[model samples]
Target: METNTQTDQVTNYVYIHVPFCLRKCSYCSFFSVNFSQEASSRFVKYLIKEINLFKQKYNIKPKTIYFGGGTPSLLTAAQINLIISQFDIAETEEITLECNPVNITNEFAKELTLTQINRISLGAQSFLDKELKVLGRLHKADEIRNAYKLLRAYRYNNISLDLIYGLPNQTKEDVEFSLDEIIKLEPEHISTYCLSLEKDVPLFSKIDQIPADEKVAEFYYLIRNKLISAEFEHYEISNFAKSGFESNHNLCYWNDKYYLGFGPSASGYLDFNSKTVCHPERSRRRDHLIRYNNSVNFEIYHKMLDEKKIMIDKIILNNDDHEKEYIFLGLRKAAGLNLEEFENKFKTDFTKKYDKVLHKFNNLLEINERTIKLKSEAYFISNEIFSEFM
Candidate 1:
């Protein structure tokens, strides 16, 4: 494996994890807890200390910052600002916060916007009342509309709304109605996903009663047609964006660029020169900074941090590891990979290395100089294609 430190590039994206929520949704398996104003205040203090450590150690400055669940909006505006103040975020940086519509008010939206958090990703899930109840979302259908209207009234220009299909007892008409409602709002971006029944969640126990595959496919087709007609680009399998409105932060991940992930359950990756970088299936380097997974227990996290053993898992990437990752992560984007770039990373043509697999599955995967996107027919079976390399 190549070990050249000088040639490696530094990552400029930073992700901060906020693991507190007002309540747990049945479909959610992410780490989050019941809301506590005092706990949030204390968490912010530790967060700042952690950020300072990064600056002192690596001298890294971030160009994009993302604040993800559990219910980032549950945090007070002051606490959010406290965290933001620590980073020398570039003027053009895209800062995003994820929120459940129940906690979003006009005042809160205005305050967050003023604090330079220009983008808000509202977990709207659905606009149908019965579906919202079944999903255990606290917000009502009207509340979703009202909260979005409030954001617009507060002048939030970059807003993304999340919608879910494949709800139990849902029909084609119901999915279309959800898309219609989303189109009416004209959000800058729309993320449409199928309901995933996670293990140990309440929904998982009742998964058998969920919509059948045939109906689920119908709902997916309905969403594709509606959103495309509405002029939103189906940039990713699950993300739709208008022109110049694609999510830059998310793109960083799909493009396999380096990013910093902070907070419990958040993961970060950066390239290191001295380390032996292995692929995700065979990685074992724990220096060049750490892979910090914060605890679901904030108290435990605090105690661990004070003892300087807060890192839950850490792996440093070597050239070969980074090269393999370029294939897996790059394939996630709709545009796929650039052939020349792949050659530069691996010092070999990826197509040449996998020619046998490519030749055998030519009809199923689209391979070209610019990309290797899966055909629409092969999308649902992507795992089968991805496994060929391993």
Candidate 2:
């Protein structure tokens, strides 16, 4: 990591990347390695060392801690506890751990109850056996159900389930079946994703089987309507939650709050200062934001930590970069971007700054006195709209 400048701000949110998985899913593109007991144990030691090094530099009292993966649940409960012990987490803090349904054994779930992980995000990709097979998921449909029941048995009330739609050869009925199963389970939160085929993934070879954009739009509305009818708030484009159960850690990202990231391939955003820029033409205050990601290669990650050095790729954001990110990331929420907040933060009139772009898609946006957001009907093509700001 770069040396902390005099103005670096403290971050309350922490994300630890656990990059070990038994098998990588066919359509996944995240950086991860094959899981092994010896490797994971060594990774945990280095992860803790990395955390302690940061702790020495900053006073970190984490309000939310997230362990995201390549299947975070693959770590033993004792290992999870050891990493978590490095933080001073309050009972009210949201500590989330992502799990593969097949890995949520009875003993594992029971042991997790003893840890500070009060929330669970289960990767129950699909409830259909065929879809699971096509996606190269290790768990079957029954395993998803059993895992849910097991978590409930262990008293984990704050659970979120993940579902993927727009799969190869997927049908409206297939989506409905999965949604029906999800509703029946009644998790506190639900995150839905459209299968995106990356360049080198196995699913890219079968991209021809993917549904048309129009059909995918149909699926999106189908899901939004179903989840809304079931009383789940469509908080973000790809996330829905029951009352008071939103993922606090993820909310930090959409809300543009500073956070710290640990482990290989994890990225973090931090603000150095909130002072106005010294440029002659611009009068707006700009956040001195810096974003960095750890090395993706395991060997380099370990070597740097062993030498007490932080190996990261870093970027310092200019005013334009910050403004574009503010617009796009804020627009992801259902409540939309607050115009008042934007004008105050950037010291520019929202309408005057993006006048031409606003006129281009006037019908697709819902603008009012305090906030501006995309209309629900225009969500499927949101990326095209977001590009205007980019």
Candidate 3:
């Protein structure tokens, strides 16, 4: 275990990664795996031990506790409680748990409600059976409705539904239909993602059958217009929330706030004074999360979590990188980047640095007094515009 400090001196958020799944997705590639109950049990014990070390090192209670994962729903409510009991989170803190429809039951939802788990992120990739099969999802279309009904019956209001577009053989009508059902459900939040042909995934092998980039872009615009017209806030590129339901955990990542991640393949970030580590990478999937372990492989992760360690394995950001990170991450939000806030974090004039990139990409990006936005047309080409920062 190691210790670090942020210049801000604030302890705000913590993330718990549950890298266990009933089964892995064909298109998915994150740290997770199928495992036995005994293994899952051991992993929980290890998580608590690791967290205790973190608490001692950081010396603060996290205001937000997020359980993100391969499939947090795989754990029984009792197991969830046991893992959470180890943390000293504030009573009013936001606690979230991610689940798939297949594991969501009335009993499960009820137990979660009683366990201080206020937020539920449902992996309802699509309500269509065909899409589910193509995506290698285990849940059926009916399962999705049942899952939501169960949550709603438990009086759970802070719910988020995930949607995926650009699937193979999917049509515009398919995307619209899914969105229509989502709008009718009126979930507090919706996270829309375009499928990426990630390396080594089963879905990546059938790349030729997937929707073309142009068609995928069309659906992207469709989602934005539909969600906006339905009164959802396009708070981030991939997230749409109703006013107050924006994801606090994800915000930590985009805003570069300090957070601790527990469980295998999970990465923790602590701000230690002037310098910081932005993104951390993992090589193995979190199989033991399903079956709890005594401890995560700390030595492997120490390099990434070490205080003020330079962000390597990808492009390193200088002052240009910082300015670009602010713009890139900031534009993903509806409020956009606060210029004053940007200047404060990077200690550089935004207009003075990367003026060429900003100027050349002006049509694609909208620079307001307090915020920078991607024009409606640029949302599809957002990656290209953001690449300028890189």
The lDDT leader among the candidates is 2
TM-score of decoy 1: 0.89
Sequence-dependent TM-score of model 3: 0.86
Better of 1 and 3 by lDDT: 1
Model 1 per-residue lDDT tens digits across residues 204-231: 8778767888788778877877888999
lDDT of each: 0.76, 0.88, 0.75
Task: For model 1, give the 10-residue run with minimal summed lDDT.
Answer: 1-10
- Which scores higher on TM-score, 1 or 3? 1
- RMSD of candidate 2 to the true fold? 3.1
Report the number of clashing residue pairs per model.
1, 1, 17
Judging by TM-score, tell me the better candidate of 1 and 2: 2
Error of 3 at 259 (Å): 1.0
